[model samples]
Target: MKRWKIAGLFAMALMVSAAPFQAFATSPEFAYTAEKWASLRDNKLEYGEIADLIHEYNTTVRQNELDYQEYKGKTSTDIAEEYYDSANEVSERIRYPDDDSANYANQIASALNSEISVTNLTEQGDSNVDDGEIKRLGYEQQEKNLVQQAQKLMISYYSGKASLATLEDAVTQAETAYTQAQTRKAAGMALQSDLDTAAEAVTNAKASLQSAKSSLEQTKQQLIIMMGWNYNDSVEIGSLPDVDTSVVSKINVTSDIQTAIANNYSVKITERRLANSQSENNRATYTNTLANQKETVSTNVKNAYNSLVLAKDSYDQAKTSYDLAEKERAAAELRLSAGTITKKTYEKQESACLSAKTSMETAKLSFLTAQVTYDWAVAGLASVS
Candidate 1:
């Protein structure tokens, strides 16, 4: 519910952003049609698409398995059918000695059954398959994330009640600044540069608003793609419903990180890459294990390990930054109300808050991915232990 609420809020923001600034007494008219976004959200996608893809992949793998037992029934039937047909032909041909039909029949039988030895299609259940499955799941999870993000955008679009409040503030700021600039110009109290600067600020603010709208639009498209829609297909976003945020705030990042590490696809992919490299090293060592080659292998391992660690650190920093930003925003608001800061300064503070939030979101994602990779590596190491 919280998620939906956030989405609704974002949707409202997007809508406002999509419209003219109204702050300049004139909103820019763009040829933006919300038809696509609306269409997409209205249609609910079934989980069948993903399930079917997985099923097909599994069936193909099973078919390729060289267990021989899997094909026993079909193999036996085919062989028997050939033998019976040959026997009938031989019986008819045996009526004459010149025929050699019996010999031919025996040869046919031998050809069909004698050389029916099973050939292994591949090494059964290699780590590659396991890793691939994990990666597919990871891709699915990424899709889900995109979908949820889209939902957030939708919520943002509809949450006009809240968004209007902020947007109004923005408009007021722009208008007031514009008026101040014009009044100073008329009174010859300010240079043209000052007026221009003020005017530019208003324009920049409009651009920012539009960019935010564009983001929501892009996010909607992303959700469509995640749901397995073609890129060319447009979706309509539905009216967003409110969601509860309590659960979101209550989520334990550390625990979620651990879970992601254990099950996320990104980790599996990295693990697979590392495994392949390790396997190459093993082969190399056996063939011509040189000091330099050994060192190279060690270096590769360290590089992969370092990536995971760096990602983890980035996430941690982002989370901390976000928390600090929240505190700073609070302080900034208070200062503004106390007349210790200008409205422009307050806006700057708000921008900082948004930046901090963005950083935190990015970091959380990175941390989850890193945790997954680290887990995959550790899991592999465990088997060796």
Candidate 2:
């Protein structure tokens, strides 16, 4: 009802920042304007606009890979030719030496001349060494990393937008508090000091709101810069893309760990890198290094899952409190009907119930945010909801 005997929102509302988010269909999440969502769905984004940037990135990386191969091949050919030129060179001093020294110099030059063949010199200083191959492989891996990074940025941008909704709600509540205090003071029921405190709260709430807008703007601009778009400050994005919650029920920690280890962009790149090695030992080294990376990825998944568990627990506690607030509110309503309590006290109880509801919603958002993060870590965006 938003009715309250108090002139201001309880201390709890100002002390705690409510985060707007929804983890599942039943979870509480912030709602966005249709216009904003339309912008995101439309062509407002410049870089990696269509979900994953893998295909476009692959095209650029492939072209660079070809150019790298050409450059390495040319360098190797140049080095081989330099070897041939060295073997063919003769010393001008060979003619002026003592007979024995001159003979020895002539013999040494003759041997180098005899070995002046492409195949023989190339064998000693092969341009097709593992170094060039490894270099190209590294380039490929770097491109893949960029794509993965873009995906993470996409997730972060949407998550921040959700918080913006919470800030907007906070601003409204603060303004409401200030208005109520002014009304109370006019009737001599509230002190000037109380009015001033509410006014200060409104100011703080507005400042926080502005800060949130600026942050969202910064995130949107980052996407434009990364995707090679013209500098634009007025990018509008809609609601977060929905996660595939169906997979949440299918998460197999062991299987997911295996998938991340085997199919992670880096792991796949390193596996391909085995072909870049010239010997068995080098191939084994690459294999072992990538294999060892599995543990780290598994740990990340577990950590994210642990956070989700904690968030769920918090949500449960909030639900219990909300239920208790509902009971208290019902009791107050009955007392008011029986003429056993003042109307102002009943209204206060109603306000407390509303506050409890808001807290419960905030907890729901927290739970959803944690769920999304955990799903992304273990099963990726495809599996997240």
Candidate 3:
């Protein structure tokens, strides 16, 4: 019965020691699997899906998530418990020692003392730092940054497409102008210098168009790759949702600053460290660090809010300009119908209208970006030092 009880205790100790390692092996927090990536390849990437996509596809963020999981799985307490359990098992065996009884007892005593020392050290370390929580917060911060980057890439890709449309129109207009200039010069109605200038404009416009096309392609490639697609893979990028400028009116800067300070990962980590600081010097240093981080978060949130306001103003101005451009283009169409404006002049007005439309689209995207930045700031992922 004694032997059976000892064996049972030893078995239970082994199981207890292995439990954390088993959990660590099975825990897959933020794990990115190949199947997940394969499934995403066929889906159209939208702005709203950027955060999830980044969490799965971004190498750095995925690695950080894994690191956090590993840290949490192998916590100091878990390790200390495992050591203590091992020492208990060895001490239990010492109770039924035979010819090497003294040897077994010495080993048991040594193991228990070592386990105690290890437990003390681990407890002291845990008291000084919340490593698991800090790592988890770090991973969260990284994911937020990657999400912002992916969003910016999406905005750039669409904005480039808009600019590409305007450039293509400009190229067509320039070519038509060059042909008309050539015709007028042949009839001696236009100066040779005028024809030369028109030819130069056509060359410049075509070069600009080509450059814009290349730039747009590069942006598309970046966005697709970030979305976990091969660089050569074909995927349709959906258009961004229309910006709602009214959100600016709902922003409360002072309230947002407080929220940012509370949510900010850096500020929170510093606070944790400050709480764990045992020495007066270390506590004071962390206190000052905490204050600086809070201040930085406050400033970042305020700046993001201000930027959103500016973006709103710019969008409003661009909308007004676009409205005016549309009216002028309408009048120019009538003038063309009445034979008062040449076809080239009317086309120039149309190009101007297209340019205005592109400006408005770009401004709207800028406002959206600012809105995202501000929202992220208030949520505790402010971009600051």
Candidate 4:
């Protein structure tokens, strides 16, 4: 989102600060939705304040990479060091007689299992090689997924705000129209039926406004839960920021699937299980399951990508329709003002424009959700072993 747009949003919140809002509490914390949304999106954004957590994560990842690199470098430059005591075990097994050889083999096996000897000293032998990487990736992906969740929630929050605002305006308009209709009817210029219809419009608009408010509150709770905050906090969300679609272009289906196969947590877990399993049947089962998992991961990525593409297409179509409706709405407003069209006709055109915009936003939300999910599945914790 542009800085100016964000500034404008805050400005709007400041404008509405004086309004009497009856929420669940009386505290004047973020009475406007824009203020709360901006806090969640920026100031109090999840993981932002927890620099220690991110620092720990980076430290761990860096150390693991260094360890892996050290292991690789040692293998390349110091073949003698690599083969030392671990390679001696193979010779020791053959050098011993039957009984001694068997006992020594058992001892060596126990040592290797316990990580107490030089038998399993390579990077492949170290459990931390996979474990460390997986943990770090999981943490990084979790933060990303949360942000994606926040983005969708933010969009919905703004949608709810718009609906509520629109309905509130409608209620006021309907009430004024109703009062005018009643006055005109008394003067014999308008019928009782006209007054009744205007009164009903007011009732309907008020009901819609209430419904919109309720929806907004529900979403607020969702955002609160996501940020690990108290639900009763003053959480008036700000305007929805635009999603960065540049990430989408970076996603490669083939490369991502390969990455998932090599790194996915489930795949890595299953691989570890297969490696550690003593039974031939159990190993075969885990291997088959892992194979199936690879296929599933591939399918999920493909499906999510497809969904995003379809959503973008849908948004394009919706936006085109909205643009045309906006033009119609403008003409309707002019016609109504000129007394060439009825107020109802003007309202219908206005509603068409609003509905079209809502549809476009809905499509945009779907695309972003799919984009986030796909990114997680292919590159993040979902993909790491």
* Predicted model with the maximum lDDT: 3
lDDT by residue for model 3 (1-385), tens: 2222332353354345443322212223334466644444445787776876665555565345445544674443554455556655644544333546768877666666766665665555444545566667777777787787788888888888878888888778888889999999999999999999999999999999899889888988887676556676767787787788998898789988998998887888888777756668768888888888888888888889889999999999999999999999999999999999998788788988999999999998899889878888898888558
Query: For residues 297-365, what per-residue lDDT tens digits would candidate 4 score against the true structure?
Result: 777777777877777677678778878888989989999999999987787678677777776666666
Clashing residue pair totals per candidate (backbone < 3 A): 37, 7, 0, 12
For residues 1-63, could you state the per-residue lDDT of candidate 1 as single tens digits? 222233345335545544322221111222213652333234443322232222212222212
lDDT of each: 0.46, 0.56, 0.74, 0.58
Best candidate per TM-score, number? 3
CA lDDT, candidate 4, residue 257: 74
lDDT of 2 by residue, 145-179 (tens): 55555555655676566566556667777887899
RMSD of 2: 17.1
> Worst ten-residue run, lDDT, model 1?
118-127
lDDT of 4: 0.58
Candidate 2: where is the Cα deviation over 4 Å?
1-148, 180-192, 233-239, 244-246, 268-288, 301-385
Which sequence of candidate numbers ranks them by lDDT, best first?
3, 4, 2, 1
**TM accuracy, model 1:** 0.38
lDDT of 3 at 214: 91
* Cα lDDT for residue 61, candidate 3: 55
Off by over 4 Å in 1: 1-180, 197-223, 230-302, 335-345, 369-385
